[model samples]
Target: MSLKSTHFHSGLTTHLIRRGSLTMSYPRDPNPTKETFGVGARWDVPAEKVHEVWVGNEGCEYVIGE
Candidate 1:
């Protein structure tokens, strides 16, 4: 499926599975940082932090779970 953006709440751990290459972006002090994940990659967001994820590549898909 195609997804544009996902918002993760603070104090909740979120699990992500990538079907293709994608990027997760978050705000920082002076600039925002981005992390890319490849196909079949799994990423876990720490419960203490809030994050926003954005799909960076065309045809990329992401599955998110809490």
Candidate 2:
């Protein structure tokens, strides 16, 4: 009795939020270098003051209307 096989691919879900994805990877070079994500926004100003700003030199990032 000998059965041992391991080659795997099955974990993809998007816009469905069971693990909501913009593509993530971890299975030894399944292709994903670095694609980070984090954005939060809340603004009507005059509440801690910071109106419009922008900065994205590495890839993309925003926390506008601080």
Candidate 3:
């Protein structure tokens, strides 16, 4: 199966499910760092956090849902 991937910006609240390994970085913070997520992992990004996502070479797939 082909892997799917997407890029996300800040100012939105949503749920993310990881289909592959990926990294999330908080650029707006004083100390920016990269957080990695594995497959089948659930992540919640609130409107307050200013961040972006980086999909790995293997590709990261996710679904947005309530």
Candidate 4:
């Protein structure tokens, strides 16, 4: 049902759902199955184009940049 990945520094387990591919994150809670937490997105970029990558991590996708 999900593709899981581990982040050592964060000590959090990330799972990628196969349906919509939505990413979910947990605070390494002791009870993973019963604990619900926030989520984040992941992307793969080339070294040459790293600077050009942009994401609306804070959920501000509507406000235009002045």
Best by TM-score: 3
Which candidate has the top score in lDDT?
Answer: 3
What is candidate 4's lDDT per residue for 1-66, written digit by digit as tens? 243443333232223222222333333445433222223333332222211111223321221111
Candidates ranked, most accurate by lDDT first:
3, 1, 4, 2
1-66 per-residue lDDT for model 1 (tens digits)? 235565556655545556667777665425878787777787777664645666655566667666
Q: Which stretches of candidate 1 lie over 4 Å from their true place?
A: 1-6, 14-18, 28-32
Number of the candidate with higher TM-score, 1 or 4 = 1
Please write out the lDDT profile of model 3 over residues 10-58, one tens digit for every residue.
5665546567766777777788887787777777776566667777777
Q: State residue 35's C-alpha deviation in candidate 3, in Å.
A: 0.5
Q: What is the TM-score of each candidate against the true structure?
A: 0.57, 0.20, 0.66, 0.22
Candidate 4 global lDDT: 0.28
lDDT of each: 0.63, 0.27, 0.66, 0.28
Q: Please give the TM-score that candidate 1 achieves against the real structure.
A: 0.57
CA RMSD (A), model 4: 13.3
Number of colliding residue pairs in each model: 0, 0, 0, 0
